[model samples]
Target: MHRPAVIALHYQNDILHPDGLIRVGLSEDDQKRTQLLVAAKKMLDGARAHGWPIIHVRVAYRHDYADLIQNAPILKSVANIGAVKEGSWGSDFYQALAPREDCFNEHVVTHKRINPFYDTQLCVLLRGLNIERVLIAGVATHSVVESTARHAVDCGFHVTVAADACASASSESHNHSLNSMRLIAEVSDVQSTLEALK
Candidate 1:
């Protein structure tokens, strides 16, 4: 069996917290659904129990925003709102989903772009840990989650996305992205994922 790892993406204050910088743009229902902290915690615990590495990924930019890419609408929104600056609380991992200090080989990977693999040490870390399959869970299903899933598939890792642990700005976008990811990755829920890890 391929060694598995859980890649929790973009579980940052700017995206998951109610008092987050971008929370105003999310619908009430979306905000409720975006509360993946509990589900992510469960997944992380399960992964640890199974001896799988847990990789927490977040997006953060320089305080000066010099490294940020504002070419796209989403990027522009992030820049305009001053979200996820390197030294700011908005860039910190969500409190409930933060990585545990006791877990061996657990990693906190930071990326400058939407895809966690882009110009990041994520691939290297996975390779060092001999990770061949990835279980992904995070916010904005249509963006970071989907982007990372597709990239993982392209990089030759078997990918599974925890459907219930991911949320978007709207239900429509979330479902749509999940359907799209289904074509390339296994789409599952947190319980099913935990069972598989065992």
Candidate 2:
């Protein structure tokens, strides 16, 4: 009955798209990027088909970067490159993954930090939807993707990561993060996640 919601993170131009300023933070290889987007689309489409609540999450900051927290090299790099500026093209979701305005079952969340739940309506939204288990995937497997998944587990919901739908700067880092997540969260492929959603 699609009890678990699906959270899609950082499918924005600044992270996932080929022209993104931070695309290298995920992967610069055409094969890896294509594989990620294709797998993510499959997961999203499968979830949507089963009527699962879908949350599209992205990281964006004001033009002046007032809301950004420069606490790390990568965090500071966001401002240096002027990436993901709120309402700018780079901050917009990738064309194919953008949620339709008319989709009532989907929501969009924009955060200023690597973790989407901090100071965001994510938890509240999940509670309102009566969701207790979540399926998640995103860019930079060791960063926002890992952060959000860990928090979801701490929040007491059962967590499952769609491994194939996530990407990172390198294979080693991505696998390392997944291994770390396995300690607290379930790690599964997109097909497995889709089957569960069904």
Best by lDDT: 2
List the candidate 1 regions with Cα displacement exceeding 4 Å.
24-31
Q: Once model 1 is optimally superposed onto the true structure by TM-score, how far is the C-alpha of residue 163 displaced, in angstroms?
A: 0.6
lDDT of 2 at 190: 95
RMSD of 2: 1.4
Each model's number of backbone clashes? 0, 1
Candidate 1 local Cα displacement, residue 173, angstroms: 0.1
TM-score of each: 0.93, 0.95
| lDDT accuracy of residue 59 in candidate 2 | 88
How well is each residue in 105-147 modelled by candidate 2, as lDDT tens digits? 9999888877899999999999999998999998879999999
Clashing pairs in 1: none
Give one digit per residue, the lDDT tens place, for model 1 in 58-147: 889998889997888988988888899998999998888888788776899999888889998999988888888999988889999999
Per-candidate Cα lDDT values, in order, are 0.85, 0.89
